[model samples]
Every structure is written in C-alpha cells, then in structure tokens.
Target: MAKRRITQETFDAAVRENMEEFEMASEEALREAVEQFESQGVDLTCIVKAVAAVSSEDTPEESTHEVLQALDSLRIGDNSASVTEVEADMKRFTEHCLVGFAQRFLAAQKDAYPVILSHCKKSVEEPEALVNALSALAALTNGQPDLLEAEGKQLFLDVLKKHREDPSVTCVAVRTVRHCCLKHEQNRQDLVKGGVLPLLTGAVTQHSESAALVKEASAALRVMCYDDDIRATFGNAHEHAKSIVLEHKGLKVLIQAAKTHFEDTSVLSELCATLSRLAVRNEFCQDICDLGGLKLMMTLLADSYETAELVRQVLSALRALAGNDDVKDAVVNAGGVQYIVIAMNRHMNNAAVCEQGCGCLSVLALRKPENCQVIMENGGALAAVQAMKTHTNSLNVQNQACMLMRNLVARMPQYSQPILDMGAEALIAQALLTHQYIADVGKAALRDLGCQVELRELWTGEHGSLSY
Candidate 1:
C-alpha cells in the first residue's frame, strides 16, 4: 500500500490546534505537528511548515505589510465584489508587487498565488481588472516560479487565447507567461504543448507596430527555447525551437518584426538574440539566410557596430547562421568577414562581443579555404589576436580566438606565419596555460600554426601505445 498523505491545510490545522488547545508554544506546536504527521506516514514536502502569520482577514491582531493586506482584500472566496472593487484591489496588488521581491516572497508564502489567480479567473470579462490582475500575477510570479502549478499554466494559455485580439492584455499576459515559464521546465513544456508558439508568433505579427509588445512576446518566445532549467533530466527545448521555425513560420514573423523595429535598438537586439535561439538546426540556419535574415543581420551589424550590446547579439546570430556550409559562403560573400572584424575592432574591450566575433569568424573559416583568404585579407586574424590581448582574463574570448586562429590556418597555412607575427603564439600559449579545460582548442591552434606544443600523454596501453 502507498503511504497516506495530507494537505497543507490539514497540517496547518493540526499545528494551530496544538497551539491553541494544548497551550503549546508556536515552535513546539510546529515540531509536534511535524512529528505527528511523519509518524502517520504523511508526506510534508509540499507543506510550507510555518505558523500562519497575520495575513488573512480574520487575523486582525498581528501586523502585516500593505502588500499582504492588499492580497487579503483580493481574496474572492464567498464575498461578492463589484468590478470597481476588483479593479481597485488588483491595482493595489500590482503596485505593491512592483515594490520588490521581498514583498512578493512574503505574499507567495501567504498563498497569494491562488488569491491572485482567483482574481484573474473572475476578471476574465473585465478588461481593466484583467490587465491589472495579470500585471500583478506577472510581478508576483517573478522568481517565484514555484507558485506556477498546472492550474496556473492553463490559466496563462487560456488568457492568451481569450485575449488574443487585445494587445494590451496579450502583452501583460505574455509577460506573465515568460515569468512563469522561466527556470521552470515543466511549465515551458506545458505551455508549448498548449499551442503557445503560434499564439506568440501571432502576437508578434498582430502587434508589429507596438515595440513594447513585440519585445515582450519575442522575449517570451526565446524563453520557451531555453534549456536552462536544471530540474529536468531532459527537455524539449530543441523541439520547441523547431516548432517555432518549421511549423509556425517563426522566422518570417521575427524577421518582419526586426524590419518594423529597425530604428529601435532595444527591440532589434532582442529580435536578433531570439533569431539566434531559433536557429537550432542546419536547415533552420539556411532558412534564416533565405528569409533575408542574413542581410538583415549584416545591416544591423553595420548600423549598430558601435553599440556593444547590439553588436554582440548580431555577432551571435551570425555565428549561429554560419553553421551551414552554404550560409558560410553567403556570409563571406556579403562582407561578413569585414563586418565581424570591424565589430571586434570597435568593441575590443567588450569580452562578449570579442567572443562572438571570434566565434563567427572561426565558423566562417571552418573547412572553407576560399573564405579563409577573405578572412585573412580582411584583418580577421589580427582582430582575433587583439581580442585575445585585450580580454586575456576572459576564457571565452581566449578560447574563441584560439579556435579562430586554428580555422584560419587549418586549410590556408600560408596565413599562419602572418598571424603568428601578430603575437598570436604568446596569447595562445598564455591561454593554454591558464584555462586547462579549454586548452585543447588553444593547443591545436599553436600546433597548426607551426609552434611546438607539449602533447601530454594521458594513458598508455600494454604495448606502449598512448592516448591524450
């Protein structure tokens, strides 16, 4: 037989009973309640395991903050509230939520999720109340992803479906969706299964003129494609990315939004980053190229090369798109080599830009001898060596620079000595000595560039054969 379990309410009731009837201390009562439940084989992992603070309506003696008081007012159990009452309460809650995470954590501990969820459910027909409720929900769930359960997931998708025509509602709803799904893999999977990709793409397409809405929806789309949640043994992040591109035509939608928001550097940065996230497969890489994404990225790079953050994103997108052989040729032919070199030169002090720029050049020079000459002639090698010299403390930049040097000289050894003359050997040796885990690429760069590298023999067979 399975072990019996009890609800948190039941456990709390037991603790409260011990406190009031038996005159036990609060801590003693909690301990007794825990022991009593564990003795009965009742699982308490889901229980909050704390005495109920003065957060509810009946508890008038204990003091609570205004945020908790506002949450208490929004509790919609038996009381009937007018539209104005709901709107006022939701607005108060949203304002309080904006205060900070301390108040949000307090409210979450007080079971504010269901109270706010109740308001979201009740205000579905009331646009004013619904938007305020969603804004509060979004703020409340920020970094409190444990509050978003199965019901919360369904409510998010339902709100998106119902309010698809309302950009204001969809915008906040998407913000809430992004907050709920971040660092919560199950929520991401569930929302994507509930057909969120098409809705997100539609939001981007429908509200193309609204830069704020487009940015939020685009960010949410990118969040769905993240595999950062560590709780799951495996995730469907790749599948979601594919669904966004192959099934829902996400490339066209994002590329169009990028064009629409070309002047908005913030929105363009987000779109470029999301574009990199969506380019997970080789065909998807080619799809980005065919959809004019390559040209758009080059233009963005040219226009925003001075903008460090935007330059980094554009370089990342180029690196992702360069995974394809034909895309590599396309990028090289479209002045990509020169753009990457210029971006790196402009942002020589920015480690992230240097990393992405070196990575892009490395991929463009991989296995393509013709492109290697273009990279060499365009100061790509010098830019990479300088990136290493500038960001010596940045292991990512060093590793990427090492890879770029190797790729530049892998097929076209004629450019090796020219690059080595630019102080490549010293930086490569320093990187190899500094970061052991990433030294393989650095070591290969040194060896391929005609520098003598010490080959460490790790294991030996019985016949004296060795392996690294």
Candidate 2:
C-alpha cells in the first residue's frame, strides 16, 4: 500500500511487468508516479503506457494536470485544432477518472468555452461521459449551455440528478430545462418533471439571497409565460405558466420581484411583462392592479427610452386585460391614457415604439370609449395616421399603425371617416402605390373606412363634426 516511484519502462516487457504489480499499488502510490514522472525526463509515451497499466478508479485526480500537460505537448495546428484533439480524447476517455482532468481545464477557466466544448461536443453520444462533462460545463455558465440547444437538453437530466439542491446548480439546470421547453415540444413534460416550476418558484420566493439571482429566475420564468414564440416553442410551458398564475402563490413572488427590482430598468422590463401575463388570470389581474402596477408602468412609459420600452412590451398585457372592468378602471385611475398617447406623439422616436404605443391605445379604445375619446382629442389617432405616411418604409411601424386603425374604426365607424377626409386615404393609397410592404393591410384599412363613411353618423358621434 506504500506509494511507489514511477521508473522508466523502455519496452512492452517493462510495462507488462508494471501491469502485473499495478493492482497492488495504493491510490497515493499511483498518484506519486503520475505526479513526479515528468521532471525525471520520463517520456510521455512511457507515462501513457504506464497509465494504461493502472486501473481507471485509481487514476490520479492530479493526473489531470499531467495529462493536460502531456496533451498540450501534442502539437495543435490552431486554436480550433487544439480544441479538437482534446475533444476526441474526451470522447475516447469516457468515464476515465482522468476525464475530470480535462473537465477542470474547460469549466473553471474564464472564456474557456471553446476549450470546454471541445471536450463536451461528443457527450451526446456517450451518456456516462455526457453527464459529468455537462455537470462541469453547467457549473460554469450558471447551467446554461452556450452550445447548440438540442444537445444541452439531452445532457441536462444528469445535472438535475447530481445538483438538485444547490441554488446556483438548480438555477442553471432549470435554465437548461426552460431552454429545452422553448426549443422543442417533445421535452416539455420532462421540463415540468425536472422541478422547473418548483425550482423557479422557490427562488422567486426566497428573499434572503442574491437579489441578482432572484431577478434572473423571475426573468426566465416570465419569458416562458409571456412570449408567444417561447410558448409555441414548448406548448406545455404556456399551460405551466397559466397554471402557476392560477393555482400557485408564484404571483405574489413576481409582484415582490418587480417591487424590489424596478429601479433596475432591465429587470423591471421583465417584471412588467410578467405582470402583463398575470394580468390575464382573473384573480391575478385584480391583484396586479391592486398592487399599483399601472402607476409603476405609466411612470416607466414617461421615463427615458429604456424605461419606455418596458411600457411598450407590457402593452399586449394591458390590451389582454383592458376588457376587465376593474383593470380598465385601474388604467383610467392611473392616468394610463395620457401617458400612452404622449409616448406615441412626443416620443415618436422609434417607429416601433410609436406603433406599439398607438396599438395599446387601440386596445383600450375598443373597451373604453372614454379612453378612446381621450386618445382622439389628444391627437393620438391623427399622429398614428401621420406616422404611417412618415414611416411608410418601416413595416413594423406600418403594420402597427394599420392594427391601430382597425381598433379605432371598430369604435365609431364615424371615427375613421375623418382620417380619410384628412387625406389619410390618399396617403394610404400613395403608400400602397409606392411601398408594397404593408400595402394590402394598408389598402384594406383605407378601403374599410371609405366604405364605412356616413356623414350624418359622424355629426351625431362624440368629437362631433369637423370640416375637412
């Protein structure tokens, strides 16, 4: 059981003799040979030959350093080449106690992805190696894979099993799980089972730790719940998102997260958007309004550009719940109408933002006629119509403008007639004549108004008669 010094083995016969006694060597003895062999001028080939004679279990953890040195000694043609040979060895070394040696090289070092992935690339094929390799990589990126999405999910199960309790570890694994849910439908149930809701839910509720980490968990969960593409990415996450809002106490945590991190605009953007979804659930919507989300969001809309975007993103959320009597009244009580119209008019900076602001007004217009009157009188509807002519080249602006026109028309058929009378029809026609990007929707919007005009009806409507 005493440690032994590694000696020169010149040929197969010497190595074979060592192999015979390899079984008797203690862990420390095997480590001493691997640790001290190189300074003695022992050739690497001989060291490897000796390494093969030893059992995989007794392979020195420190041997990883020697192995990397030995591997580094092998000529790498380029950075790409350097990564490739190590990758092949990782595949070749599957579960070799020496594998950890390569893993440490990849995971612990900064900006070491190219090197770490070089070894992890083949983990998809070898399950045993995949788990350990993925664990090491997860340990580094907070568990999110910078690699391709598909392979990361396949490798996540093992990470879940080994690191279930560590918050950073669990957070990372849950991230990969969300990544999987968003990228493919096949893995959604698996995502739910891997404790994603609970993992994210627990972190959102725990107020004692890193506000930074808690905010991150809240964000990932928020994205899964609200973004339609992500919902379609994994059909089940929508159900999970909807269910959490409906049944679990997760809503309280999100409200807390927003209240705590709102000063951080980036985090607030996420918080506001999540509140938008929670606003869809009957119980959650009332709770969100009662929490003064509208006042906070309206303030964000009036802030700098970055803060305004949070308002734009939450527009759909507002639109979704605008029909609710309580939430609708909440918007009016919070001065939501004035803030939105100002963003579209005075803040007409980004055509996309202008369009979204206008679009949000249209949603409010449909359900609240008083809100619509405030918009029309405040010059919102005209500003949007003008933006269509000004931003004819921007499809996002054009489409959003057209969508708003649709909402405006829905209220008073008479409302859109004045826009046409003001040459909006001609501008739309000219836009259709020159820009084909949104011409069909553009022309259709124009045509819809042209056919709906009733001069007498306009004279009778609110905002009454205006000579054009």
Candidate 3:
C-alpha cells in the first residue's frame, strides 16, 4: 500500500473532520482518532492546529491527554528525525497548551530523563533545539527538582558556560536553573557549588543588552539568595551579599541593569529582592547605601506603579539600609522617611510591607532623635500603632511595631506625648496580653512609653509574677 496522497484540500478536510470529532469525542474515541491520524501520516502540526482552533473552554481533558501522548511520541536524538522535527513537536506542545504534557510524559516514562539528557547533549550545536530541550527538562522537573539535581545540574551549568554568547540560550538555561532551585534547597546548594553565581553575573554584566538574560539571571539570583547558607557563603564579616557581588563586580552590573531597565518592573523587582537579601547582614547596610542602592530604592518607591512585589522589596531594602546612622541620615535627607510612611499607608493591608515599614522606622528612630521627630511628624508612629492593631495575629508585625514605638518614644522625648495620645499604649497592652512570646518587647515599649510602674503591675496581675 502506497502512502496516501495528502493534498491541500485533503489536509484541510482532514483537519476540519478531526476538529469536529474532537469537539465531541470521548476519551476512548479521542485515543482512536489519534491512532488513526498517526497511522495515516497526518502532520502533527495540523492536528495541533485543529485542536488549538477549538475554544479552550470546550476542549475536553481526554482530548488534551491524547494530543499530549501523540506529541510526546515524536522521535528525538541521533538516528532519529532531524532537529527540526523535534523542535517543531516541542513548539507545538508549548504553543498549543500541551506543554503540561511534558511533565506528565516524563513522570509516566521511566526513560525520559536519559532521553532528554541525550538530546540536550547532542543539541549543543543547535541553539533552538537546546533551548527547547532545556525548557522540556525544566517543565519535567519543575516541582520535582531532585530529577534535575540528580541528572541535569551539570548539563544546565555547561549550557550556561558554553552558550553565554547566545542570549536566548542563556535565558532559558538560567530560567531552567531557577525553576530547579525553586523551593528545593539541595538544588540551590548544588547551583552554588556549581558556581552558578559567576555564570549568572557574567551573563548580566557581560551581556548587558539582553534584557531577558538580565531579568532571568536576576530572578535566579533572587531565588538562590533566599537560602541562608548560600547567602552566608556569599557574604563575609565585613559585608553581607555585598562582598561576593562586589568581588565579581556584580553590584555595578546589577546597578547598571537597574538603571538601564528602569521601566522593566520584573527586572527591578528581582534586582531589588536580591539586594534586600544581601542587605540582611548588618555589615552590608552601609555598603548598599554607599553604592547608590539607596538612591535607586528611593526612586523606585517614588515612581513605579508596577506591583506590590517591587514595593515590598523596596521597603525591605530600606529597612535594612536604615540600620546605619550615615545611611539613616542619607535616607532621611532623600525623603525616604516620607516614602516609607507612604508605603505603609498605601499597602496598609499588606502585613509584609507594614512590618518592613515599621522596621525601617524602628531602626531610623534608634539613635537619631531628629529622625524620630521626622517619623512622628510624618505620622510614622501612628502608622506603626495602626499596623500593630490591624495585624493582631501577626507576631512579626506586632513585635516590630512595638520596637518602633519604643524607639520613637525612647529617642524623641517630644513625640512621647503625641504617640500616647494616638492610643499606642492600648495597642501595646493588647500585644502584651495576646502574644506572650513578644511580651518582653511590649513590656519594654510600655516602659519607654513612661508607664513602667503600671506595666509592671499589669504584668504581675496577668501572670501572677513579673519576670522583667
């Protein structure tokens, strides 16, 4: 039997018939249709196109399952169809909403790991195939990162090193690494051990023009930095994340990227998050501020309406930078105090922003009476009290708010009467009574509020004894 001659009319009619059958096909019928199409040598692209034409709302789960099975059966690697065949199959899967099949196929097929690994190894000369293969690996191991850590870690690192010149390849490679590192500590440690930071930093600093590369690299760093062990490895006694970033000249790279892509909120958000993570070390606070991180953060808080993520990161970074007196003075001079208060009020419902806002106020109010006065003038004290009252269940917010209140009243004697009048004492009392773990901070705040004797008596009455 000769191959059926599939003319344009024949192909279109086949697609139309398949589309009609697909709309009403049951699971078994869909499987049969897939078998018939494959047996007739119908182009996979046509089937994908026909299925894609159906309204996604009406596409049955069985149809998706059959389509995924057919697409995954496409041959890849040497001695098989050309790279174009595998790439087209992958493109179709990704484009036609069948990408979910990547994970399912890999999960069901025991040999998928070796098969994808072989293809990735052979496709080094082919960037498109390499990217698609990496993407497939990423999808397969997305939530299941042990697969990548066990097999594909070195493969991905090699891709980043060898294909640094190709922004597309670099982008997908870093993104794959980022996905593997998502919520998986072993994968993150492997990435750090594999020297991912230098590769990612090089991608950002050396290839500054590729916004996609920079964004993905920044995002990868952001995820990697979340691990305290990784952060400690990057930071030292004199600097937090700043030492490592500065060692690779990554700070300048990141700063330049933030400046260059000022409008790209995704880039800025990740970059700022990375900075905030680094600034967690007290030693890096002054360095971050001196390196112009303070100015950039102030600008972002002042202008961008992108998302709460950026605002959250900006407030967090400011909270870290405000630890140093010089940095605190600079922040106040840059009108950061006002913006911090604004963030508090704008995202009043966001516990994280409220916590960080109050944190910044707490640190700034520590030694700077003038800064404390500035906070009081900008309603920082009231905001802190309100945040504590609003997030009564959040021990973090309550503790930080208590610290802020204590700092404000302790440093600026003039603002003590104003804070008391705002009913901060009531909020503190509530925190003391509700959260015993934070009772110490609350008790200290009461003392700072000029109610030490009353707080002692209240504590004794509540607990039958007073420890502090």
TM-score of every candidate = 0.83, 0.59, 0.73
Error of 2 at 280 (Å): 4.5
**Candidates' RMSD to native:** 7.8, 17.9, 11.4
- Clash count per candidate: 0, 0, 0
Q: lDDT per residue, candidate 3, 63-82, as tens digits? A: 33333443455443245777
Q: lDDT of each model, Cα atoms only?
A: 0.87, 0.56, 0.71
Instruction: Itemize residue pairs with steric clashes in candidate 2.
Output: none
Task: At residue 340, give the lDDT of candidate 3.
Answer: 85
Candidates ranked by lDDT, best first? 1, 3, 2
Query: TM-score for model 1?
Result: 0.83
Off by over 4 Å in 2: 1-171, 207-211, 226-234, 277-284, 303-308, 323-326, 421-423, 430-444, 451-468
Number of the candidate with higher TM-score, 2 or 3? 3
Candidate order, TM-score descending: 1, 3, 2
* True-vs-predicted CA distance for residue 166, candidate 3, Å: 1.0
Tens digits of per-residue lDDT for model 2 on 1-468? Answer: 433334233332343333455643444444555444545655443233334333246642223333344234222422454445644544332223234433333323323444444444554454454444444354434322233344444445545445445555555445545543444444555555545566566666654255555655666666556444443443554576776676566667776776677667766766666666556556566776666665566666667334556656666566656757677667766777767776666656667667676666666666566666667777767888777767767767777676666666765677776766656766666666666676567756765575533222336545857899
Best by TM-score: 1
What shift in Å separates residue 336 of candidate 2 from its native position after superposition?
A: 0.9
Candidate 1: misplaced stretches above 4 Å? 1-66, 76-89, 461-468
